[model samples]
Target: MASPVSSPKKNTRNRKLCTPPNHSLFFLSLLVSMITFFGISVLSFMPISLQDSYLLPLLSPSSEPFSSPSFSSAENRSQVTLASLALTFLDSEENEPILSNSVMVPLPAHGIVGSNVSEEEREFWRQPDGEGYRPCLDFSIGYRKASVRITEEKRRFLTVAVSGGLNQQRNGIVDAVVIARILEAALVVPVLVVNQIWRDKGEFSEIFDVKHFKRTLQADVRVVSSLPSTHLRSRQTIETMQMPSDVSPLWIRSRFLRKLNGDGVSILKLQGLYSRLSKNLPSDLQKLRCKVAFHALRYAAPIRELGNRLARRMRIEGPYIALHLRLEKDVWVRTACRTGLGAEYDDIISKIRGSQPEYLRASQNMSYLQRRLAGQCPLNSLEMARLLKALGAPRSARVYRAGGEPFGGKQALQPLVAEFPNLVTKDNLARDGELSQYSNRSSALAAIDYIVSLSSTVFVPSHGGNMGIAMQGHRAYVGHRKYIKPNKRSMLPLLEDTTISNAEFSRAMRKLHAKSQGQPEMRTNKRDRDVLAYPVPECMCKHSVNNDVSHH
Candidate 1:
């Protein structure tokens, strides 16, 4: 061998000569090393300016490297620096990339860090816009119209005595509104007669806001708490007229108007007033019914405040369900549900049934299955619990019981409470003396229930009652939130069939109520007995452009 250093030079020359003068391979290797060195240097510096440009282009065969004359300028240098920094950032540990240019980069889905540009773009579309999704009634928009005050050509007043349970009274009030419009009479706010069954002693003003009620109906109908002092003094001049049990709009226009024309003030003592959906009423009057029921019939401030406070306390991050469990003492007796309670409770049911109305006495003669099919029996606590479970209501679901005490109180609710520990009641949420003032007062208590039920995420009524029907209609008019109307008629056979598996029962229940959830349209034909229960096509307006405009 030659001298050590001379020997290495001789070997390198020999290897180069043996490679057949491959200039392409030699230059390619040198270019790659230079590019790698440049990337390392750029990343080390990480200049703030190089935060948004496309860095991968530098490695692309089609694009020239940073050796271009344009990149030598100060502005171009900044752009190069930005692009380098952005690449470095993308390589580093950051959630989103900071690219100088809108370069499409492949990214992973799922997690934030590994997620790509395409996923981020998709997420941008998924995010909720400002104001969010408001599916309910916008009270602000509802009250935007200028107040409408009716000018009665004839100076006549109509004073009506309202009678019935909480719901009956409510229906009567709605009917009274329509009647007042037809007769063109100044309405005297009807009294809320004490419910004989529940023994409710609450007055109209005690539960509802008297001032708000009068002010709201001022435009549609002249409503007053009492007759004017001038009219009161002229008692003899005031002709007391009792409305017939089956009085029609035509009858009122013809015979009724003739009698009131000569009178100083006609006090129309009204009774058994309920919505007559078949009658071809004025469209304005129909809307007025909605205004009277929803807008005008607001609860007293104190009751509303209490209801809101209770709802807030009960609600977690999400909305709560208001289950109007109509399994009160009166309901059990009226429906004769004692047959299933065995002989131990037979005497109790018998005594309770004795106190019920003559109509309910006939229910005692019918079998449990017959009563259930007829929709006469209210769903018991156990049945309600099973139904809720089958409906896939989460275990942690916040349930607010809207009605009075169940038939068996805490004992009866144990099964439901065990399954859904978050279940609460007005009494449970409220302190002992907080709602004591309105204790035993059914109407006032119902008002509290109404406020809470109205604000609920979901409303499930065990049976059709005044509060249930009103709440259903109210929710429908508002953004049509989830109102689960259980098919009690069909549910009876399934619930009674103990042979069925839990999974099968749940599947059947879900299928039975598939259409009942969300926004369901009520039958508009003559078959619809309770048109006031779902006054959507007539009462509600589409809140947004995206909503179905067919009903509007």
Candidate 2:
């Protein structure tokens, strides 16, 4: 009877399910529902392609969500990494000879020109049929093809011509020779003087092996280089020949020397060298189309292999950055500013730090302590003052803040490492125990790749002086936006050329605003929507370093 009475009240009205007193389930369900609703709404507004490509496929596997696109991939900018770039090497496909045309131009006769052939010279090419045309064209082409083969194979290698031009008392052709050795080329023939030096049985020979050349053909090749001559006769020889532009002999003559007609021995030596190289050259040389093309096929493989080996030994991996610190010589010594090398280090660090994400700048600068701790008698305070003063530092400022101090050689590096914790200064790349200096190509390139890997920004001081074309070409390949220095010879040109357009200017302004909360006003005078500009840095200005630092 009591059960019947309770059941009677349960019938009349339908009551909704009210949650229990705790209501934990109710709150959780409500939270889930709200999240779902918002997510669905957001998805609806997103691009249909994006939703189909990512979200919907991730969530429901089949549902089409976003139906429109108002965003672009380009606008969604992100930092480019070394892995992503993969070190692209553009080829000079145009330079490649199209075997399509067999109508080749005849090469000029060199030996018996003007019927002034001396008895010795005439005897050199004395032939049975009264010196029948020596097939100079065919010989030249064949030699070129052989050199091409060598270039192609070594495209993975550096074609370093060790002319007397690149050699010195302390830094011999050994640096370039060692680089060639490290690359493991199919052949390594020195150009002109460098070859002579390499072949010498002196102290350098004690350190290097002339026997390596025994597997060689007559290692003679005259390479026209971009250097001034000591003798008027040499200069006249240089002035007489027509310049050709392919990486072939003609190309070398055309591109490297301003004019041709140099010494016969030099030219013959060069041809001989090429012939020797050709004899030993592999088929891979034919594949090389550009200077950069060789880098991809040849140099990078060795560098990458070396880098990977280094990483494995050091317990690191793919994400490492290369740093080439040229502590040996002043790269900018005779040119623009006679500043110390320390400033270059500072410049390198600043550039590296700026482009790197906040997380990567974890390293520090330590040149100071290294200099202090090096075991020489501590410089008297006066000696220190003079050194600092010579380095263009204000005596009142701290030694660390003293800007533009030359690295007193590699001694400066000790302090640099202390300052930067994760800084790697390993230079053990040579199979041939040669130290890398600023002028060393292999070292420079290795350092380039390292720095590029570590940081997005790279700072190359200037193109003048010893900065080689190979290095410049490398930087350009890696997306380096170049900034040339403005010297005393050109101000109006600098100002005239610095202009930018309005659309670009506007976008830059907007980007700056989006990234910064309170930026100062632009100091530019041009208000035209289509015109804009940027200034060269103080370092590049002709008014002496820091003279008008405020402009920077």
Candidate 3:
């Protein structure tokens, strides 16, 4: 009977039909089609910068998959959430991405990706991967764990005179640690050369917490208060070493290695150590710099207490704006730029600049108006006022002005004060005699400024000085609080145009600064581009989920 049944030739094709339908392959094919259809629409929004790096391979019929790039520039093109992107790939049942037709129809998917979108509005409402990557203040990337090689008998010390004002000295101190590491020598607490302008006698210990500096860098470099007692017998106070500017890691090791080993216990001192070390060092060195600047260089306990107190007072009313108003005599003289306080102020700056060859002119070719428009000069008080107002500075928001005394004195800040009357400096906010204690100590005062600026809800720098650069980097190192770096070149043109209404100017300002909002960015190897300024993808790490901020 079975043979009889078999005689039907088993209906080979029918037997195949009888089996359960294997729809997996069919579904996969359908998915691929759906993706291809919508991918065209998604590809439309693909940022031009990323088009060359990836996506092309993905679009092509290739056997091999696209190798993931180290960074994603998708955030530059669109602040679209990763979830929306996921939904775009998802099956029909799930929440759908803006359909292929929606791209043409221009329906709101989440928020439209463009300059009109406010920075705060673009914030992803959900928590980021690393506990929202916030208290975004984690610049310490296992630096505490990395061990420093200790040389017992032939201990060597690198003494560096960290010159310039507070931020400049801060950078120099950072360089000293890195150079010490490169030379494999212990670092002495940096010597703070009193700045001539501020007449600041603030020592390293008076400015930065020495114990914290030493302990924080114990694993990275041995930081000592001074050379060992044995080295004090030397005829020279500190053996001087001439280091090149923007020195490479190899150059440092090669040049200083012999010097360190020359004597049993040596102390090599170098002054004006700013920009001496290369910016694009090995990632470890860059990170070490970040560790020093962000963590190790804490203000002295007293300074911290005063700074905290002042900061508390400043913010007590409401979240304040830390404006780094660079309107000092030196700034005007050096930049050789106009103040927009009228020809009188400009004439004064010109007279001072012409009188002193010591003062720098950014470029011989760039003239005053040219420099101002080019953003080569610092934003004048009037410009700062317009910018702050255009950026929607709350009429009542207190602005904590950080930097030296304005060039025009109280008159220099009249425009800003008039627009936002709550503009207060450390002196204004300080309890009587509180700042008097550190009166002559500019570094200490700037350190106080630094602390307040770092802790502010919004930090705006009028010019790109050492302090501004450092503050921007520090602000980013912490949570990326609003840092509106005036797009000097583009912005000045907009600001000077008398025809545009306030609303239009505000729109333009928002558009110009949309991407300049203190986003974390890795430092480029461009010659003299400071690493401390751009401390991202090197000093900072982020979860893949936070690719929106990967401004690498």
Candidate 4:
């Protein structure tokens, strides 16, 4: 108090010593300013309703509008500040169009519901009573009658040499059998042509039951394993005939048979002979094609046993859903369905396109939808999952995938697996040795898939390729089973529409496929035959009716 200026300097020195520094105060002010700025920014962008209702309450606790809160404690003030910031952030996010518009529709828990599934759909899935479950036919009496007719008459031996994959070979064999029966020739056991598709050297007898084949068709046509030694000796003397592309019963009866009479044993060298479903064929010959395809083409003992075992393993109390997801690398490449796979997969698409046949390559001018509608491309895994979910396949359904590992492996199958967690394959169910036996044999592996698919309660094919077509035909022939033939062409647009909600998309799909389920109508026109896979009337008969009637 002696000197005023000196006293002020001493006071300042004392204040500096008592209070540490201005740095802490500066940081606190900066943080509060930043939070206020951030909160204002968030609120400015928020929807008007959110700002008035949600943000207003968080920012000002007092009921009076925009009134600054008087906090009793620092904790109260801090709590209010933190809450307002959080609400601002949350409200801002909630107003985002992407999040607000997205709708994830869950699939039916038990099965598909709604008006889409009809009575025929219900009956198709229902388990058959007693022996009706089995698709076995009694061709014994017919075989015996046909046998007597053939043995009594001196029939000319006809050896049909054909080639292709299993289904193609099977189709060829059916056509060959009908040809032999038409010409009244003793049919040589048809050869299963070895090719790069399966990469197996196994003979026809090695994969198929030669004895069963011979025994089953003994009456309809004499199915000999090979050309008789007598015929082999006179091989050079045998007359060779190339089957005309448009072969008919009239052609076989009127002209072809006369060529076989003078020769030691005519060799009918048939190529691409899958045209047995002609509308003009005699009913008996048509029935014979059915008998051979549906009844007589039984797999060998090992294959049958393995297929059954795999089927049993897949079924858990109820019949499993067989998904023939034809997403293998070769098939995918051939079909050129690559669209939304992204940059990483572009090289793969390019490589695949480069390798395909010129005509099959996806044209640059054609749209993705065009390619898909024309059935030139298969549904990608994601699209397949979406379609299945829409069809009312529950997430918990047991799905047995028929084909090999998909093109993209885990990445491609992720969506399907997520939807159907219980999905399985032969590789997962079968023992190492069991699968190893047919490891290199693609056809045998495919046969296993075929058998499992045949035994499934519901069969759905992702694409209408050979495996799918064969399975569809087999399922139809066995009985009018629940075969969900997806109307991919109709469903594609709905899937591509981002504007549509998940529920809306699913509803549209269900409506589109309402009548497409189960055994489709048998198409009569040769051009439309492929649509139904198996023309039911031509290839299948009611088991009861088949057993009661006797062949002439």
Candidate 5:
């Protein structure tokens, strides 16, 4: 009844409903319509598969797939959504393969693997309206990986050599093989420098020192140039042999070779020296003997080779000491060779071990001897002496009585050097620089000079070869400054085991020399006795000898 009266309020309400919308509402309606239109347009423009599989389900709850999550409550739905989105993006071939193959492309910049990716690939993923797919983890797994690349390169090319005093015993080649494989260096060739050559060449014969030929023949080898002072320091005699036109023993001296090539000097000097040195030499001296210094040489060959390589590759900027391990075989052989003799090798070894207390040390700390003798029983006196010396003990300490009496339990004369500082100090190197080779004689001399300048001490073998290089290159001073741990005097173990007796050593050396040279009438007199009998004598004359031999 009241509505039928047509009151002003009722009339206004009806007018309001009937009238067109105000400007605000009109604009709002236009905006809302435009938004809806655009939404529909975007949905239509999507890929057929995307629209059917993703956009439609997202916009319309009716089309949303039902997931029967097994958990009691859907607490991590947001996390699930994010994971789902990641999976969806990666599912596409165009996206997943991009990241996988990225590692194969050559790195644009030289940086560690953990740093920056290629710029083009990075930009490709930064789209404004894209279905956001940014990788959260740094992923690198392929040829570029450090492990893979190193292995591949190692399989390419390599050669290894094991030589004893310039290709002697040939056993060191074993170590070369072992270390080469461990470093992943692909070595295709293995060379053995036989120690037998030295014996055949005679102790002091010209051809006995075949180091030059061996060293020049191949570049890849672990060569030992360490021999007795008698051999190394002795005046070198020469023998002539057929040579290639461009190659000559005279070329041993780098400076001389360059000068001769430059001035076209005749190689008559080398020919003359060779003829004089080789004249009337024994058949054994005509060829190199690989026995006398082979043990130490073979063992150290790899390390020396590695040292040279490291010097070249890493540009080492310091002096390096090549500490030879002559204590074991040398000591045992000497000790066992002279049983009742006053200068028994075992007694000497015992004295040497006593001088260097480390000889008596147990295998607790990780010294070379400890590592080698771990879980093994105690070593003999010679073995102990060798171990002590190898651990870098002082060599000046006394190992024998003044009047040739046996100091049975004397402490090591040398100080232990296991933890000695400055073993490889930069200050120790000579300011004179690297070795040069020109004439064979000069080159040999230069090599000696280089060794002397580089090393503070030269550990020589008892018989010979050490003297050859030492005397020629001024390295003889180095040997004199240090004690010579005689090889023949040390105790020797059984054939399979490393034990020794003084008497056994003398017999072994005599037999080794005779058997090696095929000379049944060969005899070593007081020279051998003097070498095997006494500790390396200190130089008394003022020959400018350096006597600053530190324990370490």
Candidate 6:
């Protein structure tokens, strides 16, 4: 204003001051432009199904859409802008449907409605990216598959007789193959030995496809339906070695390796091979475990057909939760916990545990509440009811009961049925004569449950057991399907607190399990941890586009 062009230095200083403001304005416009562009790009590239799911909330805010965001708000607009850019990076490939029953697309933090859930509760339920890791089954850079070079003449034989239930037998069979590879021996089909207590005479061929089993493992280890004629006739040479549980490769080699090498064409039968092998092993061996569980050990066609039929029926209406209602008599007595039926049932369980000293746990000294609090006991119906409700499942949620008959029958399930009226099992879901065929075969029925459970929208185990553990791992391998492992030990205390309101309880439950959902965690080196049940660091690799999710 002081004679506009009079002082050149004054004019320059004023222009420099104006330059900073202009620069700021330029950056602000660029950020807003970039954010708008990114958000639009995400919506444009989204699948038709995902577009409906993610955009419906924005069009109509009455769903409490903004209340619990998939991605929480950033501290500032800059952070918001940065987050908008993140949508462009999800690589549309990750948005494909995993299975028909699974979430149409596994959005990082997509939330379901109507129930009171945490901001990122749906993320907890969503299958993990395994920290960007997916299932990878291959030898490392140095490791290579050297198929059995030992001639048939020098090859020894290892036959395993797996005991317990269907899942126990599965664990044993998986270990048997790795054990065969470790010992450099040909593996005969693992026998599903009769459980002395249950007297279940289920055969290997009755459950699994024998030819498929043989063909699948042919490359890694020589597999046959039976041992040679000589060994079959004179089975005495094949000592029935009752192997101790949790045996290591070193122990296996020392115990049987030298013995097998001594005799020409020696055949050894190992009993109690359930959990007989170490959890930790070489990467190649772990991959073999996955190949065995996911690929080789398939249920017979009939079992699969029935299971699929039930699964189809389950998901026909909508997504369902497969609950491993672990309230069996054996589970009760094993943990010595009250049946919640009454003091009478508790006394009966105690007497059974007392009379059968073997059923008496090493932790027998711990009281029933102590065991329940420690999560050693299966969750009874009431606790399960509370859990499902707290986890965002409404009263109308369809639930598939995935266990044998509860000890107390309808009375035991009253609480759960009261909450989730649409509860069902293979019995009700199957066709007229479908379940009748496998009514007596407990393992076959369990196999049916396993099949249906694996395909469920969500799998919630009442307590940790063979079926539950196996399902959790299988779900993770399949597509990181929603597997809610109840925070029993921790949540039990919270659940027991009567003073705490329902709102408080729900918040606590969600918070406790925030990071426990089927995330990519490597199997701990703990004893008896099944690799098939925890196949992240070993079996699964990162950004595994080649690894396809197994719907079967």
| Model 6 agreement with the true structure over 1-552: per-residue lDDT tens digits | 678589899899989877768778999999999988877676544322233233323332332211123435343343344333443443233332111112111212223554664544454344554554544555443333366362132348888888888888898898888888878888888888787555677798889877667655555677877776776655234778677866677888887777778645678777777776777776677777887887678888788777877887887766678899988888888877889899888888878887887766639577767777788878888999988888677676678998888988899999999988999988888767777777678889889888888877778898888898888777776557767888888987787798999888888887887677777566765655678788776665554232222210
What 10-residue stretch in candidate 3 is worst by lDDT?
100-109
Q: What is the Cα-based TM-score of model 3?
A: 0.72
How much does each candidate deviate from the true structure in C-alpha RMSD?
22.3, 28.0, 15.2, 32.2, 30.7, 15.3
lDDT of model 4, residue 242? 56
- The candidate that wins on TM-score is 6
Tens digits of per-residue lDDT, candidate 1, 42-126, equal 6534421222123433423232111123455576665566556556545333222322121111111112122433432233112
TM-score per candidate, chains pooled: 0.68, 0.27, 0.72, 0.68, 0.20, 0.75
User: Which candidate do you rate higher for lDDT, 1 or 4?
Assistant: 4
How high is the lDDT of residue 502 in model 2? Answer: 37
TM-score, candidate 4, is 0.68
Q: Weakest 10 consecutive residues, lDDT, candidate 1? A: 101-110
Alpha carbon lDDT of residue 466, candidate 1? 76
The local distance difference test score of model 6 is 0.70
Error of 3 at 30 (Å): 59
- Write out the backbone clash pairs for model 6: none
Best by lDDT: 6
- lDDT of each residue in 1-552, candidate 2, tens digit only: 566447745543323335344577789889999985665555434322222223211222221111122223442211112112111211123232111111111111112234643443333222122111100011123444444433333112223333322212112232222222223222333333333312332222222222322111111121122222432234232212222221233333344343222333121112222112211122122212111111111222334444334434322211121223333222221111222334665565445445643423122343333322331112222222222222222222211111122345435544433333343433432334333332234332333233232221112222222222222222322222221121212212222234745344334433322311111112133332100011111001112121111212
C-alpha RMSD between model 4 and the true structure: 32.2
The residue pairs in collision within model 4 are none
- Local distance difference test values of all predictions, in order: 0.61, 0.26, 0.65, 0.62, 0.28, 0.70
Better of 1 and 2 by lDDT: 1
Candidate 2 vs 6: which has more TM-score = 6
**Which rank order by lDDT, best down to worst?**
6, 3, 4, 1, 5, 2
User: Where does model 2 exceed 4 Å of error?
Assistant: 1-267, 270-297, 300-304, 311-327, 330-333, 336-411, 414-419, 428-472, 475-552
